[model samples]
Target: MRGSTNRNTRRVRGVLGAAIVVCAVTTALPGAASADPAGVARTAGAEVGTGVGVERVSVAPDGTQSDGGSTGGAITTDGRRIVFSSSATNIAPGNAAGSERVYLRDEPSGQLKSVGSYPIASPVISGDGEYAAYWVLLFRDTKVKLAQWTAGSSIGLNCDALNCSQPSLSGDGRYVANVATIGRPSTSQRIDVWDWHANTKQELAWFDHTAPSRPSISGDGRFVAYQNGRTKDVFLWDRDHGSTSGPIEGAAKEATLVQISEDGSKLVYLSGTDTYVHDVSTGTAHLVPNVKGLAIDPTGNHLLYAPNDTAGPSLKLRDLTAGTDEIVSNQPASAGVDAVSAGGRDVVFQSTADDIVPGDTNGKSDVFVRRFS
Candidate 1:
């Protein structure tokens, strides 16, 4: 069965240029290989749910009727582990209750484990696949709490001020970055980081009106990138330097999503018709025209984005150092590349087009992964 691609929203802008199509990464047949550019050796796209036991799931925020299940802000660097929230019981047992539950799929082992129950959202997983952080509404307390799932147990995070949401974890799973309203009388939302392994907490930034929007921590836990809600500009917090860098000079004031590279060197964001990748060292923005939905690989070298102006739109990848652009997928403009892996090797996205994969009969959007070999 097929699913839908609906999540948080972002603004769209101008048209993209004609894509430079290299040969396909790999042949459609299994075990087939094809020549490709330097950074990406070979590439192939396949359905993520195929042969993985994911069925058509109906999900909504609070028991309303929606088309597909939620990825729950869940993706990993290895492309081998996927965590999502589904309304289907068949994904794993104990989900038979018909409520939304989080499930983790270890692709290499073909093992599916139910992380927990009780209304979860915004799940972020560690690169090593050992830890997960999500928000769960505790009915008894009548407040939202951030829950940490590691090694099959659920641990409640300290959101004592009342509400907590948008949990992001470092690649190593040692540190978690989140937004919570803390202080007596629940003063305001603040961005905080917790070292789960060390059992320590550090406050990165505080906002009086609203939480720093979409706070993202680097894989190494050295930097936190977020949009300063007050200024509507991008800011990067360096743990080692103990300094915050932004309202980034060239960044758009309306920029909503800010993604920091694994090494804490580059920040990518979309502003109007252009996508800008800012160099942390130089504070310079490398502008890519007519692009949206961008992701920077862990190395900070490769960038993947969806062009808004393609005649038949698809995903494209550009090697920053090499200055080479390769068409990631040419499926229609309606199809999008949702997430890219750490090394720019694996990309996961959703498509309503049936031709994205063979035997997609259900006519619902399905998650597909492209692997660069």
Candidate 2:
């Protein structure tokens, strides 16, 4: 349980006040889509190198935080902004009641701003750079609510009484997907996808006993991938056809974790102790030989994973298409890999290096960005 933290069941109710405050304020300028026609090309070009450059953006005890004792953050397409949660302030130690709020820092401007005062979790930015989404817990009734903000406005996406978690926005910022549990542990849980433009809601699927976590939408909004069951199996729900595929044929029953490609054509999941990639288009599964921690690049052609050695995990990048792989970074023997963000020409990950504060051996992780060469 060293790196694991239980999900927050205790809900907080400061969202309504936060919403009112956000609404009363004047809207900021709309975020313009990248004017560069070659934005995608620029990102793609970076992946071909050894590994993207790594930069330490946040460190524990340094004002870094996450929701409910857990880690969560966002990395925009352009890598200019990184929004993350930290418990460095406000909350009392060992008590989850202090509330985890969302905060954003612009890398270029060095301006860190709080996105209102609500207890927000799992912040995700839209593909178009125009919107952000997260879950806010209102303490009054312990109810979890879905909330969103565009450049010009903020609104709640409706959760009358049900508890909702894991909000994912589509590339175009038109849809948000999340899991809504009606009865908690005793009752079944259902995954729902909401169409923002249409202002409608529809159930995506139902689970008998297991609740889905970490629901991810593809860049094009064609597929959603989530972890399912005690088996730790990963499943994909196709959006266009309204069908489910995999527990991917050969994926290990109890040790799998899935992440879809940005294009939604491939599914990457951990199978047993090894990681495997499945072609959603062809249903073929291939072992990403010798790679662990398996984080797929945005293009789906490359994968980033930790190696088998415990001498602190190094970031390994593999070109799935060409069947080649390489270690992008070899940190000191004391560092361990945490998470990664693979954009166009850059890849970033969290690692525990030796210089971390002593006695803070909670395995606190720090962010590192690499230029992939």
TM-score of each: 0.73, 0.68
Return the lDDT, model 2, position 126.
62
The number of clashing residue pairs in each candidate reads: 3, 27
lDDT of candidate 1 at residue 18, scale 0 to 100:
25
lDDT of 2: 0.51
lDDT of 1 at 70: 39
Q: Which ranges of candidate 1 are over 4 A from the true structure?
A: 1-74, 118-122, 140-150, 182-187, 250-254, 332-338, 363-365
- Give stretches of model 2 more than 4 Å off: 1-53, 59-71, 89-99, 116-122, 140-154, 184-186, 231-233, 250-255, 323-344, 351-365
Report the C-alpha lDDT of model 2 over 214-286, residue by residue, as the tens digit: 6777877778777665546666777677676656643435545546766777777765568888788888878
Worst ten-residue run, lDDT, model 1? 22-31
Query: Which predicted model would earn the best lDDT?
Result: 1
**Candidate 1 lDDT tens digits, 1-373:** 0111112121221111122221111101121112222222233323322322112122222212233443443457766666655565444434456576665655444345566555544456776677665676654232322333334656666643466767777887777777766554555676777775556677766666553567788889988887666556667788877776667743435665657876778888877777888898888889878887567776787788887877854777788888887666677522221255666666555455555443345444444455564
